[model samples]
Target: MKEQFAVDVLICGAGAAGLMLAIDLARRGISFRLIEKAAQPFHGSRGKGIQPRTQEIFEDIGILDRIVAAGGVYPPERLYHNDGSYSDADVMERGKPTSAEPYHLPLMVPQFLTERVMRERLMELGQIPEFSCELVDFVQDADGVTAQLAGKGGEETLRVRWLVGADGGRSLVRHSLGIGFPGKTLGVRALVVDAVITGLSRDYWHRFNDGDMTRQISLCPLAGTHLFQIQGPVPLEGDIELTAEALTTLVAQRTGRDDIQVQSLSWTSLYTMNARLADHYRMDRVFLVGDAAHIHPPTGGQGLNTSVQDAYNLGWKLAAVIQGAPEALLDSYEQERRPVAASMLGLATRLLEAQKHGNMRRGREVHQLDIGYPESTLSQEQPERLDGLSAGDRAPDALIRGAAGHPSRLFNLYKGPHWTLLGYGLDRDAVPSRAGLHIHTFGPHGDVIDEQGHFYEAYEPAMGDWILVRPDGYVGAIVTHENLHALERYLLQVGLGVPGVFNG
Candidate 1:
């Protein structure tokens, strides 16, 4: 007898990664089940920094305005000395927004708030995560994955085409797959808590230290809330209880100020810094995502953002494969994302080391705007193409004039779950039209006019240039008009030929 399938994908852990994957799949009209072992939504202020790249993603998903409203820019750090003097320092260098990059600075939305926004969005898409539902075990063969789930209703069995593990650092799915996560743990451990406090101004992030890294204590005011997230190093010698009174004593002992008090505690956790990456991201029909695939120190605020991007990168490919795209397309997920995650882990580890030595200044690298799949198999360009915006690079956004004379952004054209093809200096009638593909021509006589030449400035496209952008907003292929057949062949190879045919 043939195996029965309940859903196309079964996603474990409704954190940033799982939630994102669910949202993307839902928007694309793919069937999926998002499950979480936790009964309630996360309420911690962990992973509060939303990088600019992630902001762009939220914009594409129609949640940027909500995120912006719920968060604010990072406040300047106020360093307090032992003599009672304080000096204000910029925590990160803020950059002006450009046409190519709209969000320049990182936004400070607590992890709980970010997850809340995504959950709300998911609900709007007609799916609510199955809270307290845990994937106890799953076995995969060539056709599908059979998973045993435990929840309030009791144990149940279901089959899915793909099983994705977005469960965090201690991922049962990963452990069940027997993938090796090899890395080292740093020497520092810190206590993090969210509490209401008095005697400190909310305008700045207050830091107290007397030239000792282990003695550092910082309190950052959570945006859009009255709570302050307090963090201090855990002493190696003592067993410190995680309680309001213990935190109050800790603040007093670290700052030597009796005025500042932890009146109430909302959330608390002990954070240990470690950097680890899974030996393999995929095993047969099961895949690991986010912290399941990699985990590192949260020094540069790269953890949550990278995890969201991981889902974003895999989401479209999974949808495509389910809707008749080549199975090989899914292979690019690990090939493209694992290296990026590795690089991000390195950056976070370095930042943690720098923080230990008192160098807390963050630079543009943490923004994650420059990350791309330059070496991926999906990225294709002409052999002669050298300096211009190469394939595998992120497609830059630009302002353009629509046929109705209305001003619009390039991202608006690339927003949906479809491939976008840009034909520069080519006749509108010459471009081929196909289902699941949006084609636009640009020049003196075209569908969209580059009124201010912003598109030209960003892309630097030559006459008769054809740029094919993937559903995930990366340049997939670039070719000249004379070689348009190359674009067609590339599309066919990726299984974009037939409509409504799920070859897989």
Candidate 2:
């Protein structure tokens, strides 16, 4: 028999972006249905790393530490050269040093493990995905969206106020919107292998090159087998075809790992330099996210991270709008995230192009981010004016003293969807206050709170001051040591059920 279930949002494709968005929305009591064609979570880690920015978001949602526990933690960034001597770059220093910590270096975990942790969190929230369900067709009206879905038994119709296509590179929602995703197809194909190796160096990311372009290898340290991605322009000797066997041979030849056998083949796939972006990120009531919005060259390992960040960026907007926030708030999702996506795609493409053209310096420069969030139209607003800043940028992770002087990560306070204000230097103590907002104080001495909260004793925010953090862990808007009208403005502008008057 056919089924009919109505939700505020209908999410297609239960991948990382889809599932994360689902879990986040579920936490807010926002009704949503996440559909995945897969019977269960795919085995093996697809992506091998999670950036610090993403970790901050995960921490905000209250499951990052759990993710670290479930999927083994990856160390720092390490790059190896053919000279036998390896010099590593500090990823934590990749961009401008914000007063945050986690944004410096990303954590290493495969995409499958990420899915596992996210799914576990979803289960905890009582919103498991609607597995085996595939999106068939969808139509949007002024009021809502009606989508056709198919699964094991039959077809069902779900009426939702919004539609999110997290379906990956070949997104049907993108096609339905008639948005163009023009990308060049790289003629080269590379093989990726993930396995446990004991003897290999254990820094972070290691790469082996021929000192030229003959071959290149990227070694990512995972729980067991260091996930290795080896790529080079094909044709070793003569008219040779690029195949899995050829890649295996190349891996053996490059890493000098002919003896280090792969323990368990978690994931293997062929990848090409697909540099493309959708002409539009949003169309009417249906929006696109993750791989559906853009595909970048895998130079900086930003694919999965970018997708997850996209979920963080859009999830709140969708939930807020559905809960009666101004529709203009929803429109800002595309406005803010699209620019960041374009920037990442361009940066990744530049890195790939520099590598392909043998410009190592250019590749390194493009891979690094000295500045951020300002290039976008949404970036012009400062953390000063609004009660809160735009929710589109990456949030930072901070270390703080929790209630009772327990040390904790600043991201910990953002575990729920609420306006959390952190104050210091007040004559008194810190706790939730009169405005229904969650308020806390970290005194002069910073102490560790829980296991998830690690006090590094280094790199702490300015003490004896007030800081207002959003539920997603970003600094929404901050005021000097006192409560101001900015809080009310922030609540009305970015909060649920605010008035947004659109001029046009």
Candidate 3:
């Protein structure tokens, strides 16, 4: 016998992508079911580095504070030379927080800690993901998707308006849909472990590499914890036990340090380098995100951050579509995200190749703050100069004085799940009121005053310019006139408005 349930969306994996998607849908008052095949949350520091852009996304979703409290900055790395000499290199550069970018550097939070924070946030929102639940099969039609799930209690059937596969690389959802995951296997198998080791300082990331950089090992201290995340390339023609003694011997042999001893091992995994992308992100009503859509080498710490961004991009769109927005909006997901995923694969691959050639320093490009969809069809821009940032760019933050005589921020206004209509040099009454849209005037005698001129310089809006920000914080449309009709048309073009009004 089997029970049945229904939801607006069914998420088939409780990893970063699935959990973030669940949180977004829940906040929007959209019903969703989040399920994980594992009985408990993962207990490893696999994807440890959270990029600055991902931190901003977490801040907007109300989990950034927790993440910050549980994490610390990336430490500089100490390189051990094969000739018994060593030097230090700053693997990640630190910067001061500014109005334009609050999160200036990547954070070092264990992947498990990050998941715990996300789960707690979801609990605060009155939703909890079901663990030990597996999606055995699924079928989709013109209306919805029907899935067969097996959990601890029993088998159940779920009918959902849409389905999202955030499962890892071996995604049953993508395989069931016959989507082609095409790419090469980079042929480097790495051994990763979480353990307590002796004879290693916690001040810097300790790395040992051979002259040609073929064999390497690194032990990075996990902040706020007593353990270290260890990684090394495994030789193809070797026989080694997956035990503490074997790992300890391997670490000592590779680093030429006799005193270093692996005190204990808590977790371990063997992963191969595979750079593959699903032939498509969307197949009819079902969509794939995260590792289900693409896989990357761990060179630039992009896997988890990219996965979280994918969820952020898709979540609000899912909410809007459920709220009577045009179904055609779903098409934009593949159009916008697949290309980004492909580019990330290329970047990570290049980093891997560079590392092979002894360039181990992570560069600024890995921060991922400049990724955008300037060529997206959802982005609309006028024929003006379009300097600085135009449509499809991430909206920059600015400091301002609010009507309540208090200092405020542009990000504060754009925080929630709504469209924002920003009037740079208009009257208070000029910014119209509409549902699902926030209006703010930023000039003298208006709702807000750009006392610092940051807003003016950041956007550089013309006298009557209006900028429309989408829920995901991208510039949707840029209008240069006081034309509410043009704004409405822009909204409707992006599936954010009805026939005659903005869908508030």
Best by TM-score: 1
Q: Candidate 1: which pairs clash?
A: none
Off by over 4 Å in 1: 1-3, 499-504
State every prediction's TM-score relative to the real structure: 0.97, 0.76, 0.96
Q: Model 3: per-residue lDDT, tens digit, 1-504?
A: 433348889999999999899888888888889999999999999989999889888978998889989989888989999899999988877678778777778899999999999999999999999999999999888788999999998999889889999999999999999999999999888889999989999999998883344568889999868999888878655664778788888888888888988989988998788999999999988999999999989888999999998999999888888777777878889888999899999999998888776677775688888888888888877644447778888888888888887998888998878888888777646644557887787667668888888887778888777889988888888877646677777777655555323342
Best-to-worst lDDT order: 1, 3, 2
Q: Which candidate achieves the best lDDT against the true structure?
A: 1
lDDT of 1 by residue, 250-342 (tens): 889889898898889999898777899999999978999999999998899999999999999999889888887889888898999999999
* Candidate 1, run of 10 with poorest lDDT: 495-504
lDDT of each: 0.89, 0.64, 0.85
Overlapping backbone residue pairs in candidate 2 total: 12
Question: If candidate 3 were superposed on the true structure by all CA atoms, what would the RMSD be?
Answer: 2.6
> Listing every candidate in turn, what is its Cα RMSD in Å to the true structure after a full C-alpha superposition?
1.6, 6.6, 2.6
Number of backbone collisions per candidate: 0, 12, 2
